[model samples]
Target: MIPVNEPLLNGNESKYLLECIETGWISSEGPFITRFEREFAATVGRKHAIAVANGSMALDAGMMALGLEEGAEVIMPSFTIISCAAAIVRAGCVPVAVDSDALTWNIDPTKIEAAITPKTRAIMVVHIYGLPCDMTAINEIARRHDLKIIEDAAEMHGQTYNGQPCGSFGDVSIFSFYPNKHITTGEGGMIVTDSDALADRSRSLRNLCFLPARRFVHEELGWNMRMTNMQAALGCAQLERLPEFVERKRAMGKLYTELLQDLPGIQLPLPETSYARNIYWVYGIVLKDEIDFDAAEAMKRLAAKGIGCRPFFWPMHEQPVLQKMGFFKDADLPIAAKLARRGFYIPSGMALREDQIREVAGMVAEVIR
Candidate 1:
């Protein structure tokens, strides 16, 4: 069966990993960590980048660095991964969620203002499926309310918004180097920021808040969320080939669009918009309301045909864990709920070839028909 996702590691991945092993710098304290952080920060146009164990930890660190008070509300999209909300809740802040835009599949900026209350301290803008959130409008709102912005650029590595990089817009931003992301380090994450204090605090937070002068002593609580040197080595290699990877993704997106443009009973992912181009992190399609089946049935059929597909994120408001915690007591987001039930993405991995894409498209057409 064709895999839903496959990472391309043909660059200096092996060479870097070999170097790390040969130099005996496989741990988190190796030079590759510093080198990767420096290069990644420069690439993202950030003053500082703190490497972490994983993307979830990056969010946790970002929330900590913001110094949000307990019970402070952070406005974010309900359509995002659980990590976004988990970080806010773990940081002792309340995550106030808004629904996603039907077009861009990103957080609806118009709904943000309504979600904001006196207790709201930050706006977490998660660039969904490689499409950037409406940063201009969101930034304007943030400026008006004096709220901080935390950008989750995990799905968008080389994507831009109105000519500005996604990571550059937030007070603090994060990227994941999970295997499925544009870049891969097996498991790694980064926190990028322009604020010196945030950067320092983030570093401290990732390293157990151990004071530099005192080896084992700590002033506050923190975690051992450091990225290994081997992981950083892989990340450095991946970073070098980012431009190539981005172009490949665009080509794949275009191919999918062309192949499935006229397919019936489904809404395809959007192309370029005025604000940002759709990088098609994965080529998702939402079954029309008239369709007889939801994404689960569609995915089952696809898998039966030896084609791989994954469903969209279930809205946070609908999650059992969150619901059991007495959260979202009065929340209702129809758009996110509909998309969750109907949306699923076909194979759009970097390693996917044109023939495989055509095959997947053909299979999808057959199933839908």
Candidate 2:
């Protein structure tokens, strides 16, 4: 089967891992952790980078470091993963949902101001799929309102926005290093920022908020979300090949576009926006409104043909857990809801070859058309 994603680990991954084992420095306190954090910070143009256990923990640590007042609202894309809202809620804040752009599929900046209120403290800018949210407009809104920006760059590892790196936009930005991502640590994440205070706070939050002077005494609660040296070793190796991996993804994207550009009953991902070219984090396909079936049915058909696929994020406004919490009761994000129902992505991993891209594209065409 042509799986949705498979990590490419042809770099010095094995060598670094063997070094970690040979040196018996496999714990979180090992040297590779610091080296990974430092190199990642430099790559993302951040002053500091705090390594964490995973993406969800990165979000949790990042939100806690913000220290926002309870009940303050955070405006975010409803099309994003539930982790964004969960992090805000866990940090004692409310998440305000916004619709996505029809073309770009990122959060609609035009709808943001309408969601802002007196209690609004931040805008959680989630760079969805391949392209980034329009940072130029979002930055303007945040500046005018004096709101904090938390950039979720989970899917955009090597992406930039208008010549600036994506993870450098917000007060705190996060990345996930899952195997499906451009870079992989097997399971890891990083929180990066220019503020020393935020960086220190994130580090403390990832390590259970231990006091520097005291060993077992903690003034505030935090999580044990530290990344191990072994994971950092893998991360360092993956980081070395991020640029090459990005090019490969783009090459696959270009091939898919060529193969299925004219396929009926589907909307292809836009290759580029005015600000930035798509990095094609995943080769997302949105079934046109005229299509008889939803993404779920389409995915089933693709699977029958040995083409593995995955559905898009369900809108946060429609989440059952959030519904139970009495949030987004009156939300009306039509675009996000429609995308959730119709969108799914095919094979677009780092290890995907040109032949697999053609086969997936051909199968998608046969299934959807």
Best by lDDT: 2
Q: Model 1, which residues run further than 4 Å from truth?
A: none
**Candidate 2 RMSD computed on C-alpha atoms after optimal superposition onto the true structure:** 0.6
Please give, for residues 108-139, the per-residue lDDT of candidate 1 as tens digits: 99999999899999999999997899898999
- Provide the overall lDDT of each model, using Cα atoms, as 2-decimal numbers: 0.93, 0.94
> What is candidate 1's TM-score against the reference?
0.99
Clashing pairs in 1: none
Candidate 1's displacement at residue 248, Å, is: 0.2
Clash totals in order: 0, 0
For 331-355, candidate 2 gives per-residue lDDT tens digits of: 9999999999999999998999888
- Model 1 CA lDDT for position 252: 94
